[model samples]
Target: MTRGSLRRIPLRIFSGLLFAALLDSQALAAAPPEVPPPYIAAPAWVLMDHDSGQVLAEHNADKSLPPASLTKLMTAYVLFGKLKSGNLKLDDRIDISQQAWNAKGARLFLRPGSSVRAEDLLKGLIVLSANDAAIALAERVAGSEINFVAEMNAVAHRIGLDHTVFMNATGHDEKGHAATARDLARLAAALIREFPEYYRWFSLKEFSDGRITQYNHNALLWRDLTVDGVKTGQSHSAGFCLIASAHRDGMRLIAVVLGAQDENARVEDGQRLLEHGFRRFETRLLYAADIPAVRPRIWMGDQSTIPLGVGRNLYLTLPRGWHEKLHARVTVRESLNAPVQRGQAVGTIALDLDREPLAEFPLVALKQVGEGNLFQRTIDKIQLWLQ
Candidate 1:
């Protein structure tokens, strides 16, 4: 081969290598983003966003299993609803019944005939996971534990807990008395959202009734600064379970770990799930509620255009640093006729990421628009026909 041809051969080889490198770079850039599910040592688990009800991650989240003390969450919810509706008062006294006194598992150590303040029992029920306190409160509201279990089931159904069934108010293990991690997550979010005033008790590290002092079983509260009130349950059938919530940077997340091997496993696994969630994903306000998102042209209306917007603020949970990738498309009818009522659904607003819809909401009229005068309608018809 000629010397010059040999030199050209080296240059050609270098160019080929450079082209291959560029192709590899392009392939990496085009790859889809990944947020792998965390490794949690539990039979069933779920992590969710508080504001949006978005399930960030899960494994066996829908499987029904023993919930142990997490049943107390329902008990607390029932009492809170009563407090809100004036059926029960915080200071109202409840006479402990024989059944409540003989209740099993963790308890407030109430005597059969002794009277305890309803508020104090709430403190015991929540802070100590007191079986006695749960029963006493149940009897106070429903006259018996069986009736109170019925009330719990009714509320559970209303809140969309399809997999949850309550045999007793204290969360004792029994056939058919089970709840899934997803349902428990929903219950936790509802408890926080529905009773903000009463949720403060969950954050209390310790509660005292002038004799015995009980600390919250949720260790996350002391370990993580953002961790707040929640419930933990442990039983031979259920293993160890914890439902915890944490708030950071205006975002709140609920974590549930069920059937862990032990208390430490539950706490560690719960914390790992929460940290994985907060670290790997973030919550973003996609669009403000009640703010005009778009104004579409109106036909045969007193106004030339009608304001369109979402009814409530739209929030989305996405992989961290992915907010900029979100895009929204407004869909509306070809023409709108007036007498449009405010809040009338006229169209839909869809949110997309990577060209796929992640969520959608109804687009509604922001203001009422009356029909135009007959002459105006006629003119509009002529204009449309001319076009």
Candidate 2:
């Protein structure tokens, strides 16, 4: 080629590369701006990333304390599960027993011998923290409050709430009824995540029963546009407890405050936690389910490769400034014996930030691999011996 033509070719290649680099830089710059950390003051509180389940800030998060009306969160959780399972319906009418109406705390103005639909009662229990409504729903679901409490504890365990115990449906500060801030946040998250339809009850600012109109005790619901429905609790011993969730700019956060000195403090602390969560962090989807992270070698198996996957969806909650430092490592067993079942956990994928372990999820087998036949096994054994 002529010298001039050769020089022109080089110039064109350089220009193409420069244009691609500029486009990449512009795309990165177009990403959303990071939030700032919020200011807060409360003795015991927790801020968590709603999508990733990462603890952003914790102060006495696991210290066991009376959940007070926060106990109603568990009550609502059980009721929601029942509704989802078809055991209860919105329009189903429930008879108000004397025990439910006269249980002695947080009445929904329910009158004994009166009938109300399951859906309205739930609103009373969640929005109003009505003890009567909670008891009524519990009785309807499990035949008795005692049995229903058992189911509540069972669900708590299933949700990995290790520090929770349910003594009654109303969160009346009774003996043995308590949960920590972290535990309550987990319960709140479960409700929002597992039962989005039923969780809407928390968002209702007002509900009436033809005689009286009750307002939600959670003050943040009205004060902050980002705040949404979550339960609040108060008692002489439990002080004021709240599980508040809010969504801002596509990010959701759950904040829990237990044993605050007054109603104002509870709301203030909750807002602080939420603001901090939204400001300091961002939720990023890491890897999805059934997406292979690594290939596991099978010993004496017919298949040459076993695809490794996570058991559930994976996400990471990281500081906005540390997005570039996030990293992941997949650890799998060197070799597996035949007879692996699909969905069986075989390993773990650990997510780290600056070499610190942030989250770990079980890595599972994506497909089943049957055990080799006797002849195949014998051949494999010979091959192994040779190796």
Best by lDDT: 1
Candidate 2 off by > 4 Å: 1-40, 294-306, 330-340, 344-352, 355-362, 369-387
lDDT of each: 0.83, 0.75
TM, every model:
0.86, 0.77
What tens-digit string does per-residue lDDT give for candidate 1 at 164-256? 999999998899899999999999999998898899899889988888888889999999989987999999899999999998987789999
Give residue 66's error in model 1 in angstroms: 0.5
Task: Show how many residue pairs clash in every candidate, following the order shown.
Answer: 0, 2
